[model samples]
Target: MARLVRAALRSNEYGFALETPRAIVVDEGYERYGVTAEIASVIADGAFYYLDAPVKRMGAMNVPVPFSPPLEDMTVPTATSVVEVAKALCGRL
Candidate 1:
C-alpha cells in the first residue's frame, strides 16, 4: 500500500508486502553475516515499484570491532544512529 510507513524483517518473511513507497528496512545484524541482508536484497531486486526511494540499510561499521569499550561502542550501530536513520527515511531528519 502507498501509506505503508516502515517494515523490518529479521529471520523469515510471511506474506509481507514490499510495496511501500517510503518504507525503511533496518538491518540489526551486528555480525558480518546476517539473514537480513538476503531479505533486503530480495525485496530490493523485485519490488522496484514499491521502493520510491533507495532502501536504507544500517548495520555495524565497515571495520573490525574494537576491543576498547568506547571504541566498541562507536563501531556498532547505536540507538541514536537507528533513530537518526529512521527519521531520515521518514523525511523527518
Candidate 2:
C-alpha cells in the first residue's frame, strides 16, 4: 500500500508522501499490527494522513490478528482495498 501511494505521489507530484508539518493519520491499523516507532514517525511526518472512509481506520473486532495464511488473507486488506481507500481519500470514489 505504501508502495502504491508512493508511486501515485511520484506520478502526480503530490505532497502526500513528504514529511513536513507532521500530522500523520494512519488507518488505525498500526496499533493492532504492532507498528514500530520509526514507522509511526515516518508516517506521521511523511504520509500525515490516511485514505479510509472509516476516518478512524478499521475497528478491532476483538479477534486476534490471524496467524494462518488463509486467515490472514481473509482478515488483512488487499491492494485493491488500499486503492479504494486512496480513491475515497481523493474523493474519487
Find the candidate with the highest TM-score and give its number. Answer: 1
Candidate 2 per-residue lDDT over residues 1-93, each given as its tens digit = 556545544564436444232222334244344433334444443444542222223322336777797775656556666667656665687
Candidate 1 lDDT over residue span 38-70, tens digit each: 555666665556565765666767687788989
Tell me each candidate's TM-score.
0.61, 0.41
The runs of at least 3 residues in candidate 1 whose Cα sits more than 4 Å from the true structure, single-residue gaps closed, are: 1-20, 28-36
Residue 65 displacement in candidate 1 (angstroms): 1.2
Q: Give candidates' CA RMSD values in order.
A: 7.3, 8.3
In order, how many clashes per candidate? 0, 3
